[model samples]
Target: MDGSSPAAAAVIERVLAFLDSKTVAACKTVNRTWYTLATIQSARNIDCHILQLSLRIAHYKRKGLLKSARSLTVDVSFVDGYLSPAAYERRVRDAAAMLQSSLMPVSHLKLHASSAHAALTDGEIHHGTTAIGLLTRALPSLASLDLSDCPAPLLTASRGECVASLGRLCRLKWLSLGSNDMSSATALRRMVRANVRTLVKLDGRGDVTDPTMQLLMDAPQLRQLDASGSGISDDCLLALVRKRGASLRELILSDCVRLTRHSIAQLTPKLLPQLASLDLYNVPVTTDAYQSLFNAQTHWPYLRDLKLKAAIHHASSRQESRATDDILESIGRNCPRLVSLRLFGCYGSTDSGLSAVLGNLGYLRELVVMHHPVDPLIDEEHSSSEAGGSQSGSSNTPTAAAPAANGPSSSLSSDADVWAGIPSLPSNGLPQHSSSARRAVLPLPSTAPSSPRPADAASGASSRQRIFTSGALRNGVRSQRFNLLNLDMTYDSECAAHLAKLSHLHTLCGRMITRHAKSLIEAQFPKCRMMVWNID
Candidate 1:
């Protein structure tokens, strides 16, 4: 309906709110009133690099842009289309200029200084600090600040300056100081103390200690806390939750050494009924705890992402495997809304258990399995005599850029079916990106003559060669890897058949998958990207 009348305008506005940015952008072409409304919606979250911001500002017009904008991300990584220490400083200056003059409506500001591809230098760090100072002071309406992606060294070095600059802002609703160690106790306390009132979501992974937890417990509005890889004890976590449990929605405690099954299990539904995500990487979870926490009757109704990577040293294969099985089994029955699940190094999950998980979680987008590098492709732990037969590295070595095809000594199978689920190789024989349109029948895995077993690893160390990892197809929502991962996992035909049935599935990664099953999955899902490993 046209916006001629007030009622019609209200209805149109309400409808626009439900639609996504692309849909909202398309609505602009309908009429003048739609264009004006759509423009505001489109500019609501302005996420761009320092280079792209000026262009976006020009398109939206400075005055309209300032009023319409709500979130601004000055990611300096994309400047000059490459990551260079020299160029980063200039982009930082450009960002500072923008934050100073413009961005009144913007409340959420993300200052991504450098990238993984770029090595951090003193120049970039200095400029990054300057940019942070300018934005915190300039943006009076600033409610959220995401410094998680910024280089850790920069954040750690300029702790005092950052705390001082951030204190200038009245309060922040969300603060992320994770991904790197900037968790000095004194500085963090001051920072958290300043933003305690409005702060709701806090990511202090690696830095949040028992003392910090004490301060966080005081924050009245705090709901989400990611204290993963921190030194917070079970008693502290239990105590903090008791104080802040009413509104706590997301709690990530991955790699928290002191936390045991008892403390985690003690987290009743009454404490965090609205808990949406729980990560316990390397933390051993008991059957009773999983059943209690994930049980529909007792606990979480909205839990979505559950990362329960069994503790390697603390967990035994047979025992932890059963725990993994129990958790996955309970998932379909208990946590149906679960779209992303991570179960790494759990010895118990067979093809049937995995198939059930895939089938049950209909809209399951991300599934991470066998992440812990428990067993390498070529076992280095054993000696030549212990291994029974150790192959000579020289005779069967693959190159750095592109590894050799499945040879007799190659870790994977030589059967054609093994490549079924993944995309077909191009005419040049290089692995291409996953595409449904160009479906070429792939050739069989080529084999080479078997190399004689070497006496010892040291004798063959110089002869060793590099293998390939699928960097192009890597889709890491959970980690910087594919969905299915097994360096030496037990995969078979039945599992492959059931997994292939998931037409929505995109990325597949793992090892020791049977040739026949791998082929079945590859053939069924022609668009799926894969990084499969050996059979035996």
Candidate 2:
């Protein structure tokens, strides 16, 4: 062991690299060489919040770890009311000193003070501003600077020192000053202009407006941009898109309520060939623009992940055409290599559209369509109750007979249990539902007409006489297969059966199916994970 070869030492070093921070930290005590190597690998990305900034600074200065570290994250918001004023000030000074001292030029630095009390006084803001200024000024080689969620009043109190320091970082690539109090478009433009060639990602989600859009246009190398929750208008967004669309790979414009069809009209596959991931949550576009987005000729070879959750019409009175179905069909046609898809709150999509889309995309790994429209046939009970105030007059129904079979007291409890997420269980933890309650929830038809009805009549037939039945969910596993089966859509017994039949189904989510259907699906595909909602 004393005369170990260089190969063995290399092997040991590689092995230790795979281990976690604590293990590598522990291994440092084994030998000097191991200590040096472990420090270089793990200490480079220090979380000052976890280790405590005071301790990390002392360790860094003493052990010469700061020189090797490339990234550092300091969270000093934890120093709150527990510490005395004097002690808190001292901690702040020490943290500030560490940031100010350039023992090593850090490339990436994230200083988070958001968790600090919302009632941060003027004095506290000034102190924070001074600290941020010191840190930004110290790291000239800093490529990625995330000073997000800093108390705005504090940044404003610094007399533009923090903003001025940011403006000097010529090598900055990814900058996130989002959720801050400052709204000086001049100062923001200066920062963007300083690193126009290098800036790749900018998150101005807080106070970014039309003015900042001009500076964004200068950043030709920008790839991923997030302007969510901003007041940027269609003109600004369009300008940014036309300027940076070619280089942009990922774009998140969620909750930019002002964005209209004109803003997204230029985002065709031909224009943004490199764009892969797009999130347009709550960004309203017109019917024509929506259709143009997924045209037959539109093709994004690398486009894989897309999120259109709650991307509804901005104007309630507009009566926009339902494009959810067309969008899904287009995604299947255009983005053939698509992997992850999320359609949360897509009210336009129906059961047929969903089935058709799934049938087309065999390579889908993650599918999440929460709040999918319920099938009119399967969710008959809900529709019936809505149509007529509770069918109490129908004495033949199990719901009416429930009070007679069990006492009136038990009937109310049973009815309460019928509500999703609530179950009437005994001491044993198993639910106790009466036969009448079960029959009421899923009633079976007493009789059926022998003769087949006309096409017109059959198409318009009501679900009142529809019979409820259960069988093995895996009866058609080979026909309609999928990789990730998440039936979180509204309850459709037929759909649940179809999902259960997928042999490759790995994850089942949602509360659409009944207990009986759940049991069959779980039993057949025991390996598949079921993500149950707590309030289902």
TM-score of each: 0.61, 0.70
lDDT (Cα, tens digit) per residue for candidate 1, span 293-339: 65557635687887775454422322432444455556755666776
Which pairs in model 2 have colliding backbones? 152-181, 421-536
- The lDDT for every candidate, in the order shown, is 0.59, 0.60
Q: How close is candidate 1 to the true structure, as a TM-score?
A: 0.61
Number of clashes recorded per candidate = 8, 2
Model 1 pairs in collision: 321-348, 417-519, 420-522, 420-523, 421-521, 421-522, 484-509, 486-510
The all-Cα superposition gives candidate 1 an RMSD in Å to the true structure of 11.5
Top lDDT: which candidate number?
2
lDDT (Cα, 0-100) at 314 in candidate 1: 28
lDDT of 2 by residue, 432-483 (tens): 4465433332332222222233222112222222221122122232234444
